[model samples]
Target: MAKRRITQETFDAAVRENMEEFEMASEEALREAVEQFESQGVDLTCIVKAVAAVSSEDTPEESTHEVLQALDSLRIGDNSASVTEVEADMKRFTEHCLVGFAQRFLAAQKDAYPVILSHCKKSVEEPEALVNALSALAALTNGQPDLLEAEGKQLFLDVLKKHREDPSVTCVAVRTVRHCCLKHEQNRQDLVKGGVLPLLTGAVTQHSESAALVKEASAALRVMCYDDDIRATFGNAHEHAKSIVLEHKGLKVLIQAAKTHFEDTSVLSELCATLSRLAVRNEFCQDICDLGGLKLMMTLLADSYETAELVRQVLSALRALAGNDDVKDAVVNAGGVQYIVIAMNRHMNNAAVCEQGCGCLSVLALRKPENCQVIMENGGALAAVQAMKTHTNSLNVQNQACMLMRNLVARMPQYSQPILDMGAEALIAQALLTHQYIADVGKAALRDLGCQVELRELWTGEHGSLSY
Candidate 1:
């Protein structure tokens, strides 16, 4: 039997007929239309467009499934078709909201993974097809981790190693790996064990000019470092991840990527997030500061209002860095105290931001009377007090706020007068009344504020005694 030739008129007529019987069109009618279009050699794009045009917004689930099945039945060659064709088909399926349905379809077919893997393996030999196939594989396996873990993981890793020098292939491979590990902790651990980190970090360094590559690579690293087990290695006692990163001079690579593509917020966000995770340890904090992490973080904090998560990560990194006196001073010299105060006030409603902001201020105020003065002059004290008052119910915020105030009163008693002028005693008394565990610290702050009368009244009211 000879295949029919499809003309625009034929396509238009089919679309009109489907639209006229949109609600009445049975699954059989939809399947027949797909078969007719395929027999006529109409491009899948045209077929999809025609289907989308005739399909009502409330198209029946059965009809959608039938359309997906019809499209999947087409003999779209993995190797013979132009890369553009394959890419177009993949994008079209996704655009028609069929990827999830396709995954379901593939799951039921036991040989689905082997077929896709076969194409992927061949596509890698042809560079153009390789990118397209890799992209298609990524789309197909996305959110289908079992399929990936079972078949695609080693294939992607092999591609990553074989084409490590090709930026395009490397980018897609890293992105696929990222998709594989997302929401799958075991996959993340396996990737780490398979030495995926070095490849990803290398991508970040070698492809500095390729923002897409850098962004994907950075995103992969961010996910890899997301696990608590992996992140724990960056702690004071464990520097495993940090050691590898710094050993490969990964921090410098990251800092340069951040500087090179300063305007790419996704890259910046992911890169900053990765650096922040690595900066969890004290030694890494100093390493970050040594590599000019403070300046980048402060710059990010300057734009805190526009990017809340970025600001959150920067604050976390800053908190770690501020634990070092020299870094604290450097941060202050960089106008960090003022930025932090602004961040607190700007994002007053965000508890995480508030918690991290107060945490940073607390460290800066510890044993550093000058920092306390800077905080006071810059309204940091009022900000800290306000954080406590606003998030009075948040124990972390309360504890951090109390600790900041405790440091202020303990290290610099002279600043207590200004604090008292700001109604510090009432705040302390409230904190005392609210959090009894910090009652002693709050009471001490009140005494530092020359509020002995109020302190005694608080204790007397609570204990029914003026023993102290």
Candidate 2:
């Protein structure tokens, strides 16, 4: 059981003799040979030959350093080449106690992805190696894979099993799980089972730790719940998102997260958007309004550009719940109408933002006629119509403008007639004549108004008669 010094083995016969006694060597003895062999001028080939004679279990953890040195000694043609040979060895070394040696090289070092992935690339094929390799990589990126999405999910199960309790570890694994849910439908149930809701839910509720980490968990969960593409990415996450809002106490945590991190605009953007979804659930919507989300969001809309975007993103959320009597009244009580119209008019900076602001007004217009009157009188509807002519080249602006026109028309058929009378029809026609990007929707919007005009009806409507 005493440690032994590694000696020169010149040929197969010497190595074979060592192999015979390899079984008797203690862990420390095997480590001493691997640790001290190189300074003695022992050739690497001989060291490897000796390494093969030893059992995989007794392979020195420190041997990883020697192995990397030995591997580094092998000529790498380029950075790409350097990564490739190590990758092949990782595949070749599957579960070799020496594998950890390569893993440490990849995971612990900064900006070491190219090197770490070089070894992890083949983990998809070898399950045993995949788990350990993925664990090491997860340990580094907070568990999110910078690699391709598909392979990361396949490798996540093992990470879940080994690191279930560590918050950073669990957070990372849950991230990969969300990544999987968003990228493919096949893995959604698996995502739910891997404790994603609970993992994210627990972190959102725990107020004692890193506000930074808690905010991150809240964000990932928020994205899964609200973004339609992500919902379609994994059909089940929508159900999970909807269910959490409906049944679990997760809503309280999100409200807390927003209240705590709102000063951080980036985090607030996420918080506001999540509140938008929670606003869809009957119980959650009332709770969100009662929490003064509208006042906070309206303030964000009036802030700098970055803060305004949070308002734009939450527009759909507002639109979704605008029909609710309580939430609708909440918007009016919070001065939501004035803030939105100002963003579209005075803040007409980004055509996309202008369009979204206008679009949000249209949603409010449909359900609240008083809100619509405030918009029309405040010059919102005209500003949007003008933006269509000004931003004819921007499809996002054009489409959003057209969508708003649709909402405006829905209220008073008479409302859109004045826009046409003001040459909006001609501008739309000219836009259709020159820009084909949104011409069909553009022309259709124009045509819809042209056919709906009733001069007498306009004279009778609110905002009454205006000579054009």
Output the number of the TM-score-best candidate: 1
- Each candidate's TM vs. the true structure? 0.66, 0.59
Error of 2 at 74 (Å): 14
- Location of the lowest summed lDDT over 10 successive residues in candidate 1: 231-240
After superposing candidate 1 on the true structure, give the runs of residues whose Cα lies further than 4 Å from its correct spot: 1-86, 94-115, 139-146, 228-240, 299-309, 347-352, 367-369, 388-403, 410-468
Give me candidate 1's TM-score against the actual structure.
0.66
Give the TM-score (vs. native) of candidate 2. 0.59
Clashing pairs in 2: none
Q: lDDT by residue for model 1 over 63-91, one digit each (tens)?
A: 33333432353234555766666656545
Consecutive 10-residue window with the lowest summed lDDT within model 2: 101-110
Model 2 regions more than 4 Å off = 1-171, 207-211, 226-234, 277-284, 303-308, 323-326, 421-423, 430-444, 451-468
Estimate, for each residue in 1-468, the C-alpha lDDT of model 2 and write its tens digit.
433334233332343333455643444444555444545655443233334333246642223333344234222422454445644544332223234433333323323444444444554454454444444354434322233344444445545445445555555445545543444444555555545566566666654255555655666666556444443443554576776676566667776776677667766766666666556556566776666665566666667334556656666566656757677667766777767776666656667667676666666666566666667777767888777767767767777676666666765677776766656766666666666676567756765575533222336545857899
